[model samples]
Target: MSALWRRSDLVRATGGSAHGAWQDVSGVVIDSRAAGPGDLFVALHGPNHDAHAFVGQALAAGAAAALVDRADDHPSLAGLPVDAALLRVADTLKGLERIGVAARARSRARIAAVTGSVGKTSTKEALRHVLAARAATHASAASHNNHWGVPLSLARLPAAARYGVFELGMNHAGEIAALVATVRPHVALITTIAPAHLAFLGSIEAIADAKAEIFDGLEPGGVAVLPADSPQFERLRARAAAAGATIVTFGRSATADCRLLHAVSDLSGSDLSVRLHGRMIDLRIGTPGEHGIANALAVLATVEALGADPVQAGRSLAEVAPAAGRGARVPIRLAGGEALLIDDSYNANPVSMAAGLSVLGRASGRKIAVLGDMLELGPEADRMHAGLLEPIDRQDVDLVFTVGRHMQALHDALDAGRRGGHTASSDKMVPLLREMLRPGDTILVKGSLGSRMKVVVEALTDGEAAGVRPQAN
Candidate 1:
C-alpha cells in the first residue's frame, strides 16, 4: 500500500514533534488491537478510558508510530520503548483534527457528506459502492461519523481518491456543525428526518434542525440533497438555501429533482423507476424495502451532484448488499427446515422499526418479528414502542417477540395470537427464540444498539446454521 502520511507531512499536518525515525504510515487506527504494520495509532482519550494506556501495545503490535499527548514521565507511557516512533502533540484529538483538515485541504476528491436520523451508514456505503465503481473512492469506515470518527476518516483519505463519502452523526445540536466543518463537503445529503435523538433534541423538528447543521459547512456552490417527502423538507431546503447551497431533492414527490416513479419490493430487493431531472432510469437495488429505495434516490442525487454518470451509478446498485447488523440476511438450519433471519440488529428508531416490520410483512413464510426497545425516545418512549403495534397489525406479522422494558409496551399491545413472548432482556429471548423457531419461518430481528437485540441474532445463527447471505444493501 502507498503511504498515507510521510513523517514530514505528518509532522507538518499535526504540528507535532517527531521523536523517532518512522518514515511513512500506510494506515491510521485509534484502537491498539486493530493496529497493524505501517499503521499510525492515534491515542485518543475518551470519557470511559484513556487510549494512551495502549500506546505501548500498539507499537508492540507493529504500528509505524504512535501519536500521543502524554509525556514520558506519565504513568501510561512507562512501558513504551525508548526508540518507539512517536509524534508528541499538545492534544492528540486536536492533532488528529489538524491532520484531517490538512488531508482535506490537499485532496482533489469530490466529497459528499451524509447525515440523517436513519440510514446514514447505509446511504454512505451506497454512495461509496457506486462511486468506487467509477473512480478511486474513499469513505468513512462503519459508523465513523462522530467527533473523532469524522476527523479520523478525513485523515485517512488518500490523495489519489477521486470521490469521498462521509457519514456524519450526532445526538445533540452543534455536533454535526463541528464535524461538518472539518469535512466541508461539496455535496451534503440528508437521508430523512425522523424522531431519532429525541431525548437529546426533544422534537422531530429539533432533530431536523440538528441535521441541517451539515449544510453549514458546505463548500462554495455546494449541493444539498434532501428528502422531499419529509415534513422537514421545506425547513431543510430553507436551511440549505440560507447556506447558499444548490438544492436537490429526492422522493416520490413530483417536485423532487430525483423523484421516484414506481417501486416493486420483495423479500430479496426492490426494482425502482426513478426520474432524475426529467431523465427516467430503472434501478434494481439488492437492498430490500421502500427505505432502501429512498436511500438509493439520495445516492443518485448525490451522484448527479458529484458530476458522475447517474446511469452507471444506478446500475451499480445491483451489487450493493446490506452490511451485517444492518439488514444482512442469514438462513439458519433447523431440525425441520431452514428459517431466514433478517438481522437489522444494529440500531433502531420508530421510523426504522416500522420499515423493518414492513420488510418482514413481505416475506412468504410464517412472518415473525423479534423486536427490542427503540432507545432514546424520551418521554414518548413507551408510546412510540406501543405505536409499533399498528405496523405489526398492518403488515400482518404472524408472531412477535419483544425485548426490553420499553418493548413491553408493544408486547402488551399485541393480541394473544400474535404475541409470541416478551422478555426484559435479550439474553432471555435467545433460548426462547431458538426453541420456538421452525422451518420456513422468516424472522426479522431489530432493536437499538443499547437493547442488545444482536444477542438474539447471534443465538439464532450460532450453531447448525448456513453462512450469512447479503440479502439487502
Candidate 2:
C-alpha cells in the first residue's frame, strides 16, 4: 500500500515545519499507546490529560513521526534523537483537521456521511461492508465520529479508495456542522432521530434540529438518506431540501424510498423482504432486532444513492454481524450448562433499551435483562427510566437486574416476581447476577457508556467467573 501521507504533503496541509528524515506515514493515530510503525502519532492536548507526555512512548513504539505544537517546550522530547521526525504546528487539533480536509479535497472517491440519534456507527459499518465488496472502501474506524475522531479518520483516508464512509456524531448542536464541513460527502444519511443528548440539547425537536445539521455540508446534488418512520421525518426532509439535497427515505412507512415489507426476527438474526425504489429484494442480516432491519434499509438506501449495485449490496447484508457491545451474542459456560448473553452495553437511550428488550423476548430460555441508567435525558431521566417497564413487560422478561441510580426507577417499577436485583453500580451488581444465573438462561445487558455496564459483561466473561466465550451468530 502507498503511504497515506508524505512529509511534503503533511507540511503543505497543516502549514507545519517538518524536521528529520522521515518521508511518509501509512496511518494516523491520536492514542500514543496504539501508535505503531508507519503511523503518525498526533499528540493532542485535551481537558483531562495532555498526550504530549506520551510522545516519547509513541516514537519508541515505532511511530514514523510525531505531530506536535510544542517540540522544544515538552520535557518528554528532551533527549530525543536530533534526527527524530517531528512536525511542528500552531495547534495539533487544527493541524489534524487540515490534513483531513486535504485528504477529502484530493480524493476522487464517492463519500457518504452517517449521523443519527442512534445506529450511526452500525449503519456506517454496514455501508463499508456493502461497498467494500464492490470496490476499495474506506470508513471511520470504530466510533471515530467526533471532532478529533472525524478528522483523524478522514486524514487516514486512502487516496485510491473508490468509496469513503464516515460516521459523524455529536453531543452538541454545532458539532456535526463543523465535522460535516470537513467531510462534504456526496451521500449524507441520518439513521433516525431519537432523544439522545437531551440533557444538553433540551427537547427532542431541538435534537432533530441538531441532527439535521448533517445536511449542511452535503456536496452539490448530494442525496439525503433519512428515516420515514421518524416523527421528525418532515422536519429532517425540509432541512435536507433546504440544503439542496435529493431526499431518499427508509422505513416501514409506505412512502419510504426503501421500505421494509415484512420481517421475522429471532434471537440470532432476522429475515426480511424490503422494497428499494419499488424493487423488492429479500435480505437476511446476521444481526437481530427490528432496529437491525432499519439499519439495513438505511444501508441499502445509501448503496442506491452511491449508485452501487443493489444486488451485491443486498447479498452483503447477510455477512454483517453484530458489533461488540452492540448486541453481540456470547455463550457463557456455566457450571450446569451454557447461557446466551446479548451484549448491548455500548450505549443506550429509551428507544435502544426497548429494542433490546424486544430482542430478549424472542429468546427461547428464561429471559433476563441487565440494564443500566440511560444517561443525558435531562429532567425526564427518571420518567424515561421507569418507562422501560412497559417494554420489559411486553417482552415478558423473566428477571430484571438494574444498575446505576437512574435505573432504580425501573427497578422500583418492576413487579416483585420479575425484579431480580438492583444496585448503585455495575460492580455491585456483578455478584448478585452470578448467583442468579442458571442453565437455559438468556441474558441481555445494556446501558449508556457513562454507566460502565461493560464491567458486568467483563465480570461474567472472566475466567474466574462464568468463563464466557463469544459464539458466532
Candidate 3:
C-alpha cells in the first residue's frame, strides 16, 4: 500500500469527500468477494444487484475502505462494526472513471487498446502473455471492455507498469470512442470487423464503423494495427489516418507489415511462419484455428509497435493458450472412450462461428457441432443462421445439434441425415446431444452470450446428460 493511492489523491481524483480516518489503498475492487486487505471497494449499483449493500462484507473481507454515494441515510452504513474510511461521492461510476483517468496520468506505461466484432478478448489475452514476458504488463481481466470494465481495469493499473493493454468493446456506435478516450492508448488493434451487434447497428458496415471508433483516442503518432485481409481494410485505414495514427497492417495480404507466410496445422495445434515487415519468424501455437494465427500476427504487430522485441513475442506464441469459454479444450470420459470437447461456449457471431467450425473440421475424429443462436442479429438473423449450413457442409460434420430460436433455421437447413436434433432452448438440446455423442467425437459448442450455450458444455462435462431429461417446453 506504499503508493497505489493516497487518501488525498483519491479525494481529488474522485471529487469526493472523505469520512472517518483516511488511508492509502493498494488495490481497487468492484466485487466484495474479490476485495482483499488494503483494497478500495467501489460500491456500484446495477439493475439486478447493488454493491452498496455489501460494504460491510467487503470490509470484513479485508477491504481498507469503501467508495459509496450515500452517506447520511444509507442502510448499510449503520451496521458497520469496524471504523473503515468512507469515500463519499455523488456517483460511484463517474468516480471510478475519474480514478482511471488519474491512474493513466500517473503511469508511463505503453498502452494498447483492442476492439473488434470478434477476438477482442482473445487478442488482448495474447498481448498480455507476449508483453508480460518482457515487461511489467497490466491488462483487462476477463472481457472487461465496457464503460465500467474499461475504467475499472484502468483504475487497477500499477504506477510502475511498462505496458498496459485495454480491450474496448461496443454493441453500438460511439461506445468505442468513449472507452478509448479513457485509455488514450499509444497503439490500437482492430482484430477484424464482423456482424456482432447487428441487431442494434443494422449492418456489417455499421459494425465496422463502430469498431473503427477505437482509433479516435489514439495518442499522437500512435500505431494502428489492422487486419489487412479484411474487406473493410481501406475504410479502417482511412479512419486511422483521420485519427492521426500510423497504420500497421497484418494478415496474408502481401503488402501487410506483418504477413502470414505459411501455416501448417494438425489435430494438436499449428506451426506457422510470419513475415513481420520483411523479417521472417516461425512459431508454434498451442491453440488450433486460423484465427489463432491471425491473433498471433496482431500480437506481434502490437509488441513491435510498443518497442518490445517482436522476436521474443513470436517465441512466446508457442506457449499461448485460449482463455476459458473461448476455445479451451477438455477431455470427456465417455463409456466407450474419451472424446474431445471444444468449449467455445463463451460467445459467437457469424465470423467466429465459421472459424470454430473450421477448427472442428481439423479434429482427428468425428466432428459434431452443438451450436446455439448468434444473438443480436436484427432482421436478417434467420438468413444468417441458415447460412452456416455452407460451413457445416464444408467441414464434413457428421452431426449437428442446434439450440435457440435463431438456430432452428440452421437445424432445418441441415440435411436430415446430419441433423441430430433441434430445440427452442439450450436446456432441451443438452440431453439430446448427450445421447448423440460417441467415442472419437469432437464437439464444438458456440453461440452468443444470450444463447447460454455454456450449459450444454457444463451438462456434458458434469456427466448429467444421460441422467437428465429434456424439460417440456
Candidate 4:
C-alpha cells in the first residue's frame, strides 16, 4: 500500500525495460488475485506453473503494469492494449526481492522482526495492533514468513510509516539471515526454540541456533525478546547477547521484567493477566493454550522493549484474534445441546500438537482430539506423536482420532476407551467424525498443512447436518 516505487528505478535495478508511462509506478504485486488498480504485477515463475500466464488477468484487474518472464513474447500477452506497461524480467521472484530490499532501505520506521516455531503470527499481529494505534504501522499479511514472504511484506511497507513488523520463518539454515538482512529491524523477537523443521534443522540445538539468526539484521542497540520459561532460555539470551543485542525477557520467572500473572481459559480461549515493569494489566486472548498466554506476554514485553507503552500494548493485544485454522472455536448444536470445536489445523509440529491437546483438555464437553500427521519431524516423529498420549489421559481427553501414516504411531498407542479410530486420509476421517458428534462434545482438529486437517474443521463448521458453526469463541 506504499507509493514508493518507480518504473525507471526498477528498470535500472533489474537491467530491464519498461514501456509507456511507467515512471510514476507506486505498488508491486506477485499475486494477481490481490492486485489493485495502478499496481505493478510481477509474474513470478514458480516450479509447477509459470505466472506469466496470469499477466492478462492482472491487466484485467486494472493492474498498471506487468513485469513478466515472457522471453518469447508469449502470444497471450500480445493482445494487451498498448497503454499497458508490459515489461520483461529474467526472474520475477528475484526481482521482487531486490525491490523489497530497496523498500526497507527507504523506510523511516522502527522495525521489529519476529520468528519461531509457533506464535510468530500472534506476536507480529500483537505488535502491529499495539503500534498501529500510536503510529502508521506496516505488517506482514498472513503467515508470510518465508524467502518470498519476507520480501513481499517489506515491499508492502510505506515509505513514511513510523513502525514495521515482519514475521520471518525458515525450515532450514541460512534462510532467516537473507530475510533479516533485508528487514534490518530496530528490534527482533524469537518466540521460542521448539523442535520444529527437524527434517532440515537436525536437532533442537540446531533449531535454536537457526531461530537466533533473526538477530542478523538488528541495528546497533536493537532489542531481542525471549521467553524465560522456554528450555533454551539461557541459550537464547546468550545467543542474542553474543550477537550484540540487548535481551528482554517475559514469562513466569520472578526476575523477568515482563511477566504473566494468570489466565482464565476454557474451551473458548483465555483472558490474560500481565505484569510489565511493575504494573499489572489485564488482557483477553483468542487462544486457550498456555503457550498462547506466554506468547501474548512475550509480545507485550517485546513491544515495550521497543519503546511502546506496556499498558497500551497489553490493552491492544485484547483485539488480536486467532486465525480460523490456527485456533478458531466453532460450536456444533447437538440433539440435546451443543458441542465445541477447536480448529488448529492450519499447521502442526510436536510442540503445537501438545499445546492444542492442552487446550482441548480445558473444554467442558467430552474432549476429543482429531489429530493428523505432523510432517518434517525427521526421526522423532513417532515418538513425539506417541508421547502425546501421556497427557491425553492426564488432561481427560476422552477420544483421539489419528490420521495419516505419521499419526499411525499415536493410533497404535491409544487405549480402547480413548482411541477413536485411525483414518488414512482427512476426507475419509471427516464423515466418520461427523457421525460421532453429539451435543456437548468438544472436538480438536490439528495437523500439518500437508495433512489437510482443516477440511475436517470446514466440514464440522459448515456441515448443515451437525447444527451450525460454533459460537464458543
Clashing residue pairs, backbone N/CA/C < 3 A, model 3: none
Q: How does each model score on lDDT?
A: 0.92, 0.91, 0.89, 0.81
Residues 248-345, candidate 3, lDDT per residue (tens digit)?
Answer: 99999989999999999865578989989878899898778988888888999989999999999888888878766899888776765778889999
Estimate the TM-score of every prediction.
0.97, 0.97, 0.96, 0.93
- Total clashing pairs for each candidate: 4, 0, 0, 3
**Which lDDT tens digits does candidate 2 get at residues 1-473?**
46999899999999999988898999999999899999999999988988888888899998999999855767767777888889999899999999999999999999999999889888899999999999999999999999899999999999999999999998898999999999999999998888889999999899999999999999999999999999999999999999999999999998998999999888788898989987989988988898898999999999999989877898999999998899999887776578888999999999999888989999997999999999999999999999999999899999999999999999899889999999999999987877788778899999999999999888877644553333221
If both were scored by lDDT, which would come out higher, candidate 2 or candidate 4? 2
Across 1-473, the per-residue lDDT of candidate 4 in tens digits comes to 34556677677656666766655556778888977787888887677877777888987887888887636567666776676677677777877787788788777888999998987887788788889998899999999989888887887788888889999999989999888999998889888777788989899989988889888789999999888888888878888998899888888888787887877886556887777878888887765688788788887877777777777876776677777788878776555567888888988887888888888888786788999999889988889889878778778888899899988998899888778889999989976776677777888899999999977887777755455333231
lDDT at residue 276 of model 4 (Cα atoms): 84
RMSD of model 4 against the true structure: 3.0
lDDT score, candidate 4: 0.81
Question: What ranges in model 2 sit over 4 Å off?
Answer: 467-473
Please state the error at residue 271 of candidate 3 in Å: 1.0
- Candidate 2 lands at a TM-score of 0.97
Model 1 scores a TM of 0.97
